[model samples]
Target: MKPELISFKLCPFVQRSVIVLEEKGIDYDITYINLKEPPQWFKTISPLGKVPLLKVGNAVLFESAVIMEYLDEVNPPSLHPTDPLRKAHNRAWVEFASTLFFCQFNMVMAKEQEACDSAEQELRDKLTQVEQQVEGPLFNGEVFSLVDAAYAPLFMRIAFLEKWHPMGLLDQTPKLQRWSEALLKRESVKNSVVEDLEQLYRDHISASNGFGASRFGNA
Candidate 1:
């Protein structure tokens, strides 16, 4: 069955699944929806009323992590560490990526400079923690895995956020910055998002008119 991804165009979580699909050479259909004014059908079907939903046959899978794991398993040569303990560690970090996303959103939504600074510091601290775990080339050495897919969207968004705001989030950590660059250059990561994703992301922050908006407005 060809999987159909229900997504909000700007959702980083949804982009994670898209990266895995592209990396695995999985042929899938994608349908974009307006998150601000979700359709009635989406409202009725989505248990959490959120995107990154995978529609496979009649089974609807919610949550990006679940969807990515399912896709990896059904496809061959799972994108996870073969070592049991290492795989669990990777999964934990995959969950860690969620906190980073929340922090990124908080930074973007901060209405005051102090609030934005605090949010940025929180994000930076978490990133520093992530820096220590990274093995190099990819999340777990040279081989790419689902853990990499999970965090690519965060790096992608950070790149865009930094472009407009110059927060230098990754600057302090050489290893993390290298990992981010390597991931960004990967064809799968590069093709994971929409063509005008930067503009769309900028528009999102611009619409918010938060502390982030003031920084990105001129760019």
Candidate 2:
């Protein structure tokens, strides 16, 4: 039986899973969940109550990064590089993109503009380090690998954020800017991203007079 993916439309984390599924050419059932009313079963499987949960028979997976790795292991069109050093470099950037960059990006999403500004400065400093570590098209050199897979969604979200805020967040890191542009151009990335949902989100927030705790209801 094919796997089932439970995901939110606007979530970049969920988009990561979709990218892996497309890259692996896996046919699966996609169930869109209302972010305001996630199914009870989803919490049981994910434990963290997060979207982008994947279920295949008896196996269940959570966390977009872990889920993508699992899918890559079972499916074709490997997202990770075979070379040991390249693989390590990929993993490093993936980690930085998630833990470092996304954390800061989330602050902006959460409506902490001042905090976001500070976080963006800190993230820019970190991206300088990342820029020094990478030299070519993908973090692994010529091929798109797990790192690209992992970082793509974050970059997409950043691009969306840039559309509204234009904080010059990616300005200092030319490597990341190039990487993001290339990744966003991929069919897998393009198809996985829900641009409509992003626009809707922007509209919703605009209607609410900007995001606040009351707007999302204690999320």
Candidate 3:
């Protein structure tokens, strides 16, 4: 049976797993569901009632990082290093990427400018740490590891946010800035979501009337 991925169109977590699947050249079916009103079947399969659920054979997987690791192990040409320590090191960076996403989420949900400012500065500080540790063109050099998959969405959202406001998160991190630009061009990153993702994101933030969206109004 072909693998199936349950996803929400705008979800970055879902996109992380999608990029892995695409990079592996795996033939899988994807089902996009409304997260707001998830169907009973989705609720039944997803332990956390979250997306990027992978149905492989009889097994179901939750959590994007877990799913990415599973896919890497099951498939050939592993995205992670072979050495145990190296793999663990990459995994640590993957966790860091998750933290960055959480910070980005907080920034997006911030209703007040002061809250958004705090979240944005926090995210910038975290990115600076990543910038200090960055290896190069990709997270782990030329090889695109799970770290890259995890971070692609963060940069994608930043790309959207940059259109509405000035985000100098990369001003001091030229290497990270280049990495973001490179990830944005990857086919998997570009194809992971519905077309017009920027528009959808803008709509979502505008609907919330968050600080990011409010900038456009004040401008």
Q: Judged by lDDT relative to the true structure, which candidate is superior, 1 or 3? A: 1
RMSD (Å) per prediction = 1.0, 3.7, 1.6
Candidate 2 TM-score, C-alpha based: 0.84
> What is residue 164's positional error in candidate 3, in angstroms?
1.7
How do all models score by TM-score? 0.97, 0.84, 0.95
lDDT of 3 by residue, 91-188 (tens): 89888888888888778778788888888889999999999777899887888888899999999988878767876778888998999999999999
Q: Which run of 10 residues does model 1 get worst, by summed lDDT?
A: 210-219
Better-scoring candidate (TM-score), 2 or 3: 3
Tell me the tens digit of each residue's lDDT in model 1 across 7-52. Answer: 8989999999999999999999999999999999999999999998
Better structure of 1 and 2 per TM-score = 1
* Span of 10 residues, lowest total lDDT, candidate 2: 210-219
The TM-score measured for candidate 3 stands at 0.95
By TM-score rank, best first, the candidates go 1, 3, 2
